[model samples]
Target: MNKLKRRSDMLSKRNVIIPLIALASLMCCFQLARDLVDVEKNLDYCVTQAGKTLAQINRDSVFPRDIEKDGKRWNFVRKEEWTSGFWPGILWYLYEYTGDAKWKIQADRFTGYLNPLTRRPAVDHDLGFQVFCSFGNGYRLSHDPGYKKAILRSADTLATLFNPKVGTILSWPFMIKKEKWPHNTIADNMMNLELLFWASKNGGSKSLYDIAVKHAETTMKNHFRADYSAYHVVLYDAASGKKIRGITYQGYSDESMWARGQAWTIYGYTVTYRETRDSRFLDFAQKLADVYIKRLPADLIPFWDFDDPEHGLKDASAAAITASALIELSTFVPDRTKAAQYFKLAGQMISELSSRHYQSRDSNSAFLLHTTGNKPANSGLDCSITYADYYYLESLIRLKRLAVNQTIYDYLR
Candidate 1:
C-alpha cells in the first residue's frame, strides 16, 4: 500500500513536468513553423519570378531579336546544363507540390532535350550533375521509365570518366588553355560518386563501387588540407599512385580557402562518411564546417572566395551550398547543434537573398540574382546561375521532406 501511494505521487509529478515540457516544445515548434512559412513565401515569390523570366525567355519577341544568345528558344536555355537541367529540377518540384500541368510539360520538354545527351555520353566529370540529379530525382518522384533509363545511361557515361590507371576520377578532361588538366579535382569527382554507388546497387556494377572507393580513399589522403579545408585540386601520377602536386586554383590561388569548395568538402565527405563510416570523413566535415562557421557574416552569407581579400562578404551560392551541406551533415553528427546552426544560417541567408539579391523587378529571367559562377574563373560574376537555383530549391525540398520523415542519416546509420 505504501509503494502504490509513492508510485501515484511520482506519476502525478511526471504529468506536470511532461505537460510543461510539451508546452515549451510546442511553442518552439510553432515559431520554427511560422518562420519556415515566411521563408517559403519568399521561395514562392522567387519561383514565380524565375518562371516569368524563363517564360519570357520562351517568348522570343520580348528580348532583343538581334541577339542570338538571348532569343526566345535561345540556345542558351530551355535545356540542360549540368544539374540545372534546363530547370527540370525546379519544374519537378513545382509539379510535385502543385500538380501543375504546365510544369510537367516543361519538365518533359527538358527531359526530351536531355535525352539525346545521354546517348553520346558526356566525357566530363559532371555527367551526374548534368543528368543524375535532374533525371534521377525525377525518376524517384514520378517513377517514369524514361527518366530511369536516362539516369542509367548517364551513369554509364560517368563510368567512362573513371580511369583505373589513376585510381581517381577526372572531371573537365577538356583542356584548359589547350593543356589537358591532369589534376583530379576533389569536389567534382566526389559529386559523381553517389551516382556510381547508385549504379553499383541498381545495375550490379561491383567494379564501379570499388573504383569509387579507391578514388574516395585517394581523395581523403590527397584533398584534405591541414585545417580540414581541402585542396581544390590535387594532381596524382596516374601510374605511381603518388600525389604529384596540389593547387589552390580558384581557392586563394595559394591554397588559402574557397568557400564553395569548403561547402563541397563538407557535403562530399559527409557523403563519403555515410558510405564508409570512416571517422576521417566525418572529422573532415566537422573541421571544414568549423572553418566555415568562423567566417560566416551576420547575413549568413559567404564571400566568393573564402580567404579572399574579402572572405564571407559577397557570395550567395556559397551560403546555398553550405546550407545544403549542413542539412546533410546534421544527420551524420551525433550532436546536431552545429547542424542546427548551419540550418539557421541557411534560413537567414534565404531571407537575406530574397530581400536583397533576388530579382523581384525582373520578370524575364528565372532565379534570384547574385550567384557567382566560377568566381575564380571570372565567369558569370554576380549573375543568376542555374545551379544556385537548383541547390536552393533542393535545400528547401530537403527540409519539407524531412519534416515528415527521419533524416537520410537515420536510415543510413
Candidate 2:
C-alpha cells in the first residue's frame, strides 16, 4: 500500500511538471522580448514638457548654496519631500523613449545636485519616492555605479527610521504631537518599499528589504479594514504591537474612502505583490483595484475622494496612479480573462486622459486638469502638479511599450 501511494504521488508530480516548465519558459520569452510603444507624438510631448518643467526650477531657488561639493550641480533648497526625484525621473523616462543623450546629461546633473541635501541619506519617508523612480531607473538603464550607490545609501538611511517596536518606518520628525506621520500613515511607508525591491534585485543590502517587508506586513494588518478599503493612518503603540487608535487624515471620517489614498494603496500593493509574489498581497491589490473600478464613472476618471462631500474637479493624479498600478498588476496575473479586464480598464483611463483630459502639450500644462493634491486637507486645490504630469506620461509610455511588444498587453484591451 505504501509503495502504491508513493508511485501515485510520483506520477502526479511528473504529470504537472511539464506544464509548469512551459509557463516558466513563457515568462522568460517576455523578459527578453520587451516591446516598446512607438507613440512618437506623445513621446515628444512628454520629453519636451519635462524639459520645460525642469528648466523652470531655478537652480538658486530650488537648490541651496553648495549642494554639490565641487561648487557644481543643483542643491536641495529645503526639506523637500519626494520633489527632489521628479526631474531625474522624468529625464530618465524621456531617455527611455528618445534615447537622448541630453536627457542623460540632465539626469547626471540632477544626480550631482543630490549630493549636498538636507536629506542626503534621506531623513524622511518620502526618500523612496525621491530616488526610486529617478536614480533607481537611472541605474537600471545606464549601468552607472554612482546612481546605484546613491540609491543604496538612501536605503541605508531609510532603514534607520525603522522602529522595531512598531514594525514600521516612522516618517516625519514629530511634525504633530497628535499625528506624528508615517508613524501614523501606512501610505507613506508603502511608497518607500519600491526602492527596497529595486535594491534587492541589484544586490544591495538585505536590511532595507527586510525593513520594508516588515513595515508592509505591519501596515497590512493595521490599516486594512474588513472590506479591504485601507485607512489613511494607523496609530500603533511604538513599544508594543498594540493598536492605539486610527485616523482618517484625508479620508471621510474613519471609514470613508479617500480616492487618492485608495489609489496610493492600490499602487503600493501592486508593487508589494510585484516584489514578493505573495498571493495575499495580490489579493489585497485586486480588492483595491475592484473598489477603484466600481467607483469609476463613464469617463473612467475618479473623483478626488469617492465620498467627497462637495462635487469638486476630478483628480487626474489619482486616476493616473491607478492606471499605472493596473498596468503593473496586469503583468503579474496569469489568467487572460482577468488580465484583459484590467488592461481595458487601464486603457480606458489613458484613452480618456490623452484625448480630452490633457493634450500632448509641451508648455507648463503638460498633464490634464482636475488634480487635487490633498484635497481632504485643501492643499494645491485645482492646480497643475509636476509629478502628475511625469507619472501620466510614464503610464502612457508603459502602455505604449506593452502595445509595441506583442505581449499579453498587446492582446489586452
Top TM-score hit: 2
Instruction: Write out the backbone clash pairs for model 2.
Output: 35-405, 37-400, 37-401
Query: Which 10 residues in a row give candidate 1 its minimum summed lDDT?
Result: 60-69
Task: Give the top-scoring candidate (lDDT).
Answer: 2
Instruction: Summing lDDT over every window of 10 consecutive residues in candidate 2, give the lowest-scoring window.
Output: 63-72
lDDT of 2: 0.64
- Return the lDDT, model 2, position 229: 73
Candidate 1, residue 353: Cα displacement in angstroms equals: 2.7
Q: What's the distance in Å from true for residue 195, model 2?
A: 1.0
How much lDDT does each candidate structure score? 0.60, 0.64
User: Residue 40 in candidate 2 has what lDDT?
Assistant: 52
Over the stretch 268-340, how does candidate 2's per-residue lDDT look in tens digits?
8878876676788888788888977887777888777777766566777788888878876777666655755
Q: Which portions of model 1 miss their true places by more than 4 Å?
A: 1-39, 59-86, 275-279, 310-313, 357-364, 406-413
